[model samples]
Target: MPILSKETKAAILGAIHLKTESVDVPEWGDGVTILVSEMSGLARDAFYAKKEGGKVPISQSQADLLLATVVDETGALVLDESDVASLQAQGTAVLDRVVAVAVRLNGMQPAAVEDAVKNSAAAPSGDSGSSSASTSASQ
Candidate 1:
């Protein structure tokens, strides 16, 4: 195959390629459904950065992933960093249900999330600066 031109490559990279799914959360209310979208490469990177070496808590990690993946009809994120506390206050089962879908949609194994939750319980709590370093490097 002939090599693609720069413009073609740019167009491909700029396209909206993430997949989305509707999640049912009966616990929240009767027939309550939410939309979740697959994470973009940058979003996924930021997610892993926060959980790098399991420094962050499991609840925090789940909230961060939810904030990144949960979207509106237009694929824009519905939650922001300010909503982390509120998201954490939500039911664990509900969070896990949605987070599981986001993880699978983003190509992450369920086992990894389980391990992170387990490891985070024993992991220390503090800014190790690893995530900051990653963010800096990416920038």
Candidate 2:
């Protein structure tokens, strides 16, 4: 409902590069196998490699673990709260940019996007209002 188009998702995924790869960890070893991308360590493959069927987002636990815990150079799980916060912030920022860019790329004006967000956030309770709003927005 919050304007989650494929282009938006794809932009975020492409920017995030959510994939399993090795990272450099000087403290433990040379490299560690973990779920990470070029940008941040947010595991999200389903969204990147989505097919025609449906979209499967990353689970909350997975994200928490990936961001909060990183495999050390010695293949040890290390919990770093600061790292978690940083990764979360980076992911959020990327998503925000992707949404903004995607909306513009989809031919939605700034005002229209604002209206769409408002409509989606607090849509009328009744079915009639919802239907009418949807019809109007589509036009």
Candidate 3:
């Protein structure tokens, strides 16, 4: 294969390459459906960042993923940050089903999400004393 020029590489990187699928949700209502799309690299990175230091709650992580991947027919996001609480309030069965699709489309394993939740739950909330103790011990 010929080596791609800088312009060609730029064009390839700038193109829309994510995939979208329609997810059926009988639980929501008869004939209810939603458009789920693969998260872009940047979006995926940001999603993971939310889990960093275990600051984000498990429900918020799920809501964040939903907001990032659930889009409309025009490929625009259907939900925004303002809708996070509403999304979290949704039935867990339907929400998990949709989130599973988003996770698969984004090439993330279910274990990753489970692990994030576990880590977050185990993390100390606003407890800096542990760190200070470790620092003093080392010194």
Candidate 4:
């Protein structure tokens, strides 16, 4: 299960958080339909296109496409190093914004949560302190 090193996992998660992270998509963000259509260029259209007429790749073409498309961001289909660097910069900016928000939120400790955990833990078992036992159940 642990095939990759820590650095590799970080790189993989960083790239994923970059692309899948939500950002304004220009004029297409008006509605779901429009956004879907606009992003369709980066969707499975190429994969399906190959499947349509049996033009599918048989080797490293698949690997090359995966790296090029995700790193290009604009779907320009060019795999130049500068193109990838530009896309990477955009993604990293988004990631930095998200990480900053998380840091700010973690600093803002909610009193209710603190009270629940602190009071409960300081109290005794079966004495209402057990109420602080964390649970995943939903209402």
Query: What TM-score fits each model?
Result: 0.69, 0.22, 0.68, 0.21
Lowest summed lDDT across 10 adjacent residues in model 3 is found at: 130-139
Q: Looking at model 2, which ten-residue stretch has the lowest summed lDDT?
A: 35-44
Clash totals in order: 0, 1, 0, 0
Sort the predicted structures by TM-score, highest score first: 1, 3, 2, 4
> Candidate 3 vs. truth: CA RMSD?
13.3
In TM-score terms, candidate 4 sits at 0.21
How displaced is residue 76 in candidate 3, in Å?
A: 1.3
Task: Give the alpha carbon lDDT tens digit for every residue of 8-58 in model 1.
Answer: 777666678789999999987999999999998788888788777747778
What value does the lDDT take at residue 91 in candidate 4? 44
What lDDT tens digits, residue by residue, belong to model 4 across residues 1-139? 2234685777655443222223343332464111001112344445335446545333333332333333234333334444434334444444344333322322213675477568768986655544454453420
Relative to the true structure, how large is the alpha-carbon lDDT of every model?
0.84, 0.41, 0.82, 0.37
- Across 1-139, the per-residue lDDT of candidate 2 in tens digits comes to 3334676776655542222334333333456234222223222233233323665343323334454324444434454545545444445444343333323433345787588779888876656533232443431
lDDT of 3 by residue, 6-98 (tens): 857776666687799899999778999999999887888887887789577667888999989999988888999999999888888888899
TM accuracy, model 2: 0.22
Residue 113 lDDT in candidate 3:
67
Q: lDDT score of model 3? A: 0.82
Q: Which pairs clash in model 2?
A: 29-73
